[model samples]
Target: MSPARAATSVVDVVAAALRERILDGDLPPGERLVEGALAADHDVARHTVRAALRVLAAERLVVVEPHRGARVAALEAGDVTALYELRTALEVEAAHLALSRHEGRLPPAVHEAAASLAARCRVGDPRWVRVSEAHTDLHAAIVRASGARRIIEAHGALAQETRLFLLRIRPHLGYARLASEHEELVADLERVGPRALRAHLRASAAVLVDQLA
Candidate 1:
């Protein structure tokens, strides 16, 4: 590849790396993103770091100010509420669609995701990031089962934010509680159907929203 292409690839790689860290809670909300520090840490140029930050800013994962530079997006309580409301709506629909298309049986991927989540929660004080990823993966599995590419695309960013929110709420929810919830969720999806799934999602959202308040 040419030099320009190589540079673009590097910027993309750096941006993806930073985005994962932000989503994983390694870089928590409101934490400053120093370009110089990141460039040095990643062994890239300052301008490359700036490009990566811009990418994150566009995704709403980082907020860039005129004078203060970039920081992880500090979602307010209202922001969290709005996100969860949208999430519930889309996920509820996805669950309904999945069940309708698949004869009321969730794809095996959803069950696998549920099992992974349970295993993560069984670990003593599992890292919140791992638990959060597992949670997102389970939901993603359900959405993907809906057989709608656009819905899955729309859910990608929302899932990342949901994972972040889950990390923030993990201390209050506890690992055992989360594990039990997933076990129930899988059972409900396979046996109880979409109504139960919607109720479960709404209740989970309410619990997280309450923590934000």
Candidate 2:
């Protein structure tokens, strides 16, 4: 492989590993990140670790302090609202466009994933945490089907930001509401077409904001 490609691969690998840990609350918000330690853990050089962190910092997943160095991005209410609102707008449009362009049906794997998450949503905090992941993926998959890479990327970052709030606050979004919302979102996507989908997206965003408040 080309040297550039090899470098890119290292960056992507480190970014992804950190992304998963941050999402699942392994790297909780406000937690300090030690670059050398992370390098040792990931078997990468310190420069490679810093490079990966730069990517996340650019994405607003982590914050880089002046002298204190980098830490997981602090979860803030305003930031959470902004991210979720952006996601809702992008996803609503994607849903409406998908319905207008495609013929019918939720992708089977997507449906199955949503179903699996719905069940797990009714369980404990760890289970709820896993379910939150599936929930993000399911919504993101719907956006991806729109065949709009830019929108998908934009919403993808927003999804990551939203996960921060969910983890930091552990908001009272307990099982029933989460499962029911996903089920309703899927059902609405199935029936009433794009309009219902958009409405649901807006409602879901509002619910998130309210929960944070």
Candidate 3:
């Protein structure tokens, strides 16, 4: 109701709209996001647009540079490698914890997530973004199975970046392969433990980095 609160709410709405556009590939990487144009389009003040850009920048979805203004963040090979390195560390550990905690059986949620992803892939023509979302959900489910709050929180932080990276690489990886590989990983996790997950992450990182190159 207050003026300040109202302004903050507008900023959130604007930022969320922009975020969805970027993540959905409607606003491709390197596309400039001019504050003046966005302000006019969204019917908000320039300062509000500026604040919305800041929110996206914090998520690494936008790059705000001096004079050049803001643009959708470009995917770099180095960033891909770095993200996967962190993912390997967090996810592999999560897999270990999950297997140990559940007496070598994965939680039912993991199977459910995998099934959901497989079903999505079975569609006649799957939207890459939807497939990517399902892929992310399956991995998040694996992390959740760990029941380690800190591990879950850490992996959750990477979700957006992971989705972005996956989107870029999905074409190269193929929808069917993505679904099959994850299903295989989940099936083998109990027998092989974290090794399966580490291998999966490392392989994906290699593919993405190669594509970016």
Candidate 4:
């Protein structure tokens, strides 16, 4: 790779590591991200660390202010509301489209995602980051089944943002409840219908909003 491209690649790698740490709660919200410390820990130059932080800032996973450096982004009630509102709209439509496209039979990916999530739910106090990823994968499968390429692409970014927010509000969601909900969602898609799935999404969103409040 070219010199510039190599630097970009390193930044991506460092940023992903930091992102996982943030989502896994190793670095809690509002924790200051020291560039020099990160550089030493990651064995990269300070400039590379700065670049990585900038990439995270673009994703809204980190916040940077003049002279203050970067920190894990602190979420507000409004942020939660906006993210869920848009997420709900996209996911509800994806469910409907997937059903319409597949004639009520879910795609294989959807089933796999559901099974993975169900298993994770059975684990006691499963990590918030893993739960968030499994949940997003389940929804992404639904969107992929819709065969709407653009919607699938859009939902990918939403899925990441959803995971970020979920990390913050995971205290409100129980492992048992998450497992049961996924189980119910899979059953509803098979037997009941899209309306049931939509209701489930809205209800889940409401719980998150309440927790944030």
The segments of candidate 4 whose C-alpha lies over 4 angstroms from its true place after superposition are 123-126
Residue lDDT tens for model 3, 139-179: 99999999999999989888878888877876677778888
Estimate, for each residue in 1-213, the C-alpha lDDT of model 1 and write its tens digit: 999999999999999899788876789889999989999999999999999888888777889998999999877778777877788778878888999998888888998998999999898767767778888899899999998888888888686667667766766678889888877887887687777777876676677667668
Q: Write the per-residue lDDT of candidate 4 for residues 102-148, one digit (tens) a residue.
A: 88888888999989998877787677778777888887887788888
Error of 2 at 76 (Å): 1.7
lDDT per prediction?
0.83, 0.76, 0.89, 0.82
Candidate 1 residue spans exceeding 4 A from truth: none
Q: Hey, what RMSD does candidate 4 come out at?
A: 2.0
Residue 123, model 3: lDDT of 91
For each candidate, what TM-score against the reference? 0.88, 0.77, 0.91, 0.90
lDDT of 2 by residue, 1-213 (tens): 999999889989999899888877788778888999999999998988999999888778899988898999975557766765676688878877666666755666557777877778866554545766877788877887777888888888676666665665456566777788778878778777666766765565565566557
Maximum-lDDT candidate: 3
Model 4 reaches what TM-score against the true structure? 0.90
Alpha carbon lDDT at 22, candidate 2: 85
* Model 3 stretches with alpha carbons more than 4 Å out: 1-5
